[model samples]
Target: MLNDFLSHLFPRVVLRRNLAFSYTFCLGGLAFGAFLLLLLSGMLLLFYYQAAPDKAYASILFLESSVWGGGYLRSLHRLCSHTLLVLLMLHTLRVVLTGAYQKPRHLNWVIGCLLMLLCVFEAYTGYLLPMDQLALWATQTGMELLAIFPCGPLLRGILVPDGIGQSMSLLRFYALHIMLVPLSVMGLSFLHFYRIRKNKGVLPYL
Candidate 1:
């Protein structure tokens, strides 16, 4: 039924794939699967976390020290996030080098670009979730870089909450890490993959 709908909407959908599997899907699938793993780990962490300052850090400690498999889950989440960033970058470069950005596939090109940006955002926000010294310094650096914009105040208003303590930033980061960035990336990913099917798959050179 899904195939039929796709065929009606995009005649090239059926033509997109060769009788053999696509190499692109292999790479994309790995990145997407890693993203799912990160999400799952994050959700499990959420069950044990409290957003408040005193408890938030304590919760992570508890996860590491007391909870079985907690350390492994945390490490897995970090690794997957890093892997997703690398894979997405490689995937984008592969698409671009193959001339996949031309003609009817230009929209997909734009979607791919947005996904890359979102991936970076996702990584930056997620780095702050652990609330460690490294995370704090990294977030501070990120904020400084963001403030370099001519519209620094406006950007700060959105990215930083005024008068609140350190936890506010962590909460903000966690929200974007878990929610906004994922939604945007996931939506654009659907558009990007759909375009691949619509355009009869990646270009031969691509």
Candidate 2:
């Protein structure tokens, strides 16, 4: 039954020891799995997180010291986030090396690029939520770097509104981290995978 279903979904050649399919280390699958893990761990963290600047740091401390498994959950989320970024870069490099960005798959390539940007932004916003001295300085540095661009001031204004470590800024970052960015990543990932399957899977060798 599984064989029949797979045969319908993939070409017979793909199932018959094709080097392209078999040789791939399934980096994309690994990245997607890491993303899902991050999502689960993040959701767990959300329950103990406070979005306001005043309470954010204290909330994290409480989670780490008081809540059961909180430290482990937070560590898992952090690890998965870093792993996802590395996996994404490797996956993109592999696609480029294989010339998988050619005509039929070009659109998916663009979508993948967008997904990468969103993932980075999501991580950045999450970085600010801890509200510790490190997070504060790191976020400030990021804002300063953004301000170097032509529209940096304007962009920073839109992002922080009042300033870093302020209530509005913390709330905005939290919302983008947990809501907007994740939703966009999910939508783009769906499109990216759909296009790959539609293009007959991972652009066979050469």
Candidate 3:
């Protein structure tokens, strides 16, 4: 009467033969590690980051200038975000080169692509949260470019229900940056890992 799939799904181990670092170069694991660091640093930042367009920049300035080690935390967050991007790209490339995307592994490949896209969007949405001039203008230009595409205006509306730098827009971005995107990434990561285990990815188990 219940799924219990997770119980059956987990508890399986990867083959020792597949454990060679050269097989994957650990890019995926490194990417996941960077993602975990981002989560930690980002959570700490939440206490200091103001979400409103009016107060956001000031709050970040205060965090950097006044809060002890706050600048370092922000820097670490930024570094991890960039590192995660690079690691994901390299990991995807390695997967393609290794033919991991063939046959039963294709679904995992799609999931991975979604993960990369989510990370990118998470960065894009977070960029405007501080409400700084450079980010504001850059994101505005990006949005404008997006509008040039078919259905782009509709997508933009969903992303920013009000004007750019407006309260609603900032809040929406804040929500997505802190909550929705992270949760979605974590959820998909679980599924991705499960699929890897199920498919005996990289090498056969047992």
- What is the TM-score of each predicted model, taking all chains together? 0.84, 0.89, 0.89
> What's the lDDT of the predicted structure labeled candidate 2?
0.85
Ranking by TM-score: 3, 2, 1
Write the residue-wise lDDT of candidate 3 on 108-139 in tens digits: 89999999999999989888987899889978
- Computed on alpha carbons, the lDDT of every model, listed in order, comes to 0.74, 0.85, 0.85
- Give candidate 1's root-mean-square deviation (CA, Å): 4.0
lDDT by residue (107-162, candidate 1, tens digit) is 87887888888888899877766667787777788787778889986777677775
Candidate 2: list runs displaced more than 4 Å: 1-23
